[model samples]
Target: MSRLVKCENGHFYDADKYAKCPNCSRGAGPKKDVVMEGGISTDLDDVKTVAMNIRGNIKSGRSVRIPKVSGRTIKPSNEILDREEQRMRELQEKIRDHKDSLEEQVTLAKESYEIDNDKTVAVHVFENGIEPVVGWLVCVNGEEKGRDYRLIRGRNRIGRDSGMDVTIRKDQKVTREEHCSVVYDEKSNLTFLVPGNGTLTYYKGEMLRQPQQLCSGDAVEIGETKFIFISFCEGERVWKNEEE
Candidate 1:
């Protein structure tokens, strides 16, 4: 289509075809090139320099080179790049799943039971022929009642009946200030040493008894009160003899 344009001679021109004028070899447009120089920034001076170099190389008709590695063709196109990124994401998910499973196994292996009260309970041995390790619940009357974890010791003494050394492994030490009592729950009425003067008292499931000494299958009464005798549970089964 023809457009109305102004010429340099201050005259209006109506062109049928929007073509340059052959009379003065000039077009109905600006005489100089419109150079669009981007805004300059001090921080991006290096980036601008690199961009300028690339533009100069392009203007000079230089070709960029990309090396190929062994067992590979030319560097992948944009489509191949997207596929490689997806494969990497899948591998990361599998790695995370394996790590979680390993952590769960470690946590389960470290689980164990807790000791709560001071009561005699049966336990199993890991081996035979060893001095059985005694297992006592830290509860009284099948309740969690012991507040302190005290370490007490006892030495075997000569028995008055058998004229032999008597060894016992079920003695417990309690402070006189606490007014604590032994509540035995054994069926055989065995004996143990109480570290004080009063007769030891034990508690059966139903009744309490006071006796001169602590024994299994038997309860001890100190005065008017009585306590039941509780059994000793060990980690191993060993030979038992009444002689000393």
Candidate 2:
């Protein structure tokens, strides 16, 4: 079938050129003013010929026309919308579970350093790069001193109290009852505090927020005992001077 072309006069033509709209003829301009439907191959020769013919048609003040397609509307089905929602929900659940897994891992790692009893002694290390570690001494009656022994968390100067590094030694046993087991506060930064039947009171700097994580070589304090903080993943306790 011959390719159909629409002309400015609203006429459909198989002919390469068509008449121009009479309404646009008042200016007495050349046929170049006519607008034709696009789909034709415009080789140089064809362009010249079509242009010349259109010019002539415009001079004659005639009309050209083309066919118009009937408009149609499409709407998505309910099933499609339902499937999209389901896919989105699945993706959301996947994200949530991944986060939960990370939190669980952090909890397990913190719990690994939990001190078992009051007599069990272990240092709270904050070697991690972020967040300061503080040490609060637990009183015999089971209360963390809010004032005395409230050393700020962070790097403990080499000659602070008795003049010793705060890092924990390899082979030290951490007891849960006497000392606090390591636990991560809401911020995910590891915290070592004593937990017991005695009233747990906040000490100086206790109200401060914790950072997200710790870096090796960071220092943290637990009560009167100061500890060098290290990642639980690659640290060993060193013990030699225990009072028998």
lDDT of 1 by residue, 156-243 (tens): 2211123222211123332223122222212333333332222233334222222233434553332233333343532233334234
Where model 2 places Cα greater than 4 Å from the true spot, the runs are 1-75, 121-239, 242-244
TM-score each candidate. 0.21, 0.26
lDDT tens digits, residue span 196-229, model 2: 2112212232521222344344443443333334
CA lDDT for candidate 1 = 0.33
User: What's the count of clashing pairs in each model shown?
Assistant: 37, 53
Candidate 1 displacement at residue 207 in angstroms: 57
- Once model 1 is optimally superposed onto the true structure by TM-score, how far is the C-alpha of residue 54 displaced, in angstroms? 24
RMSD of 1: 22.9
Segments of candidate 1 deviating more than 4 angstroms = 1-75, 112-244
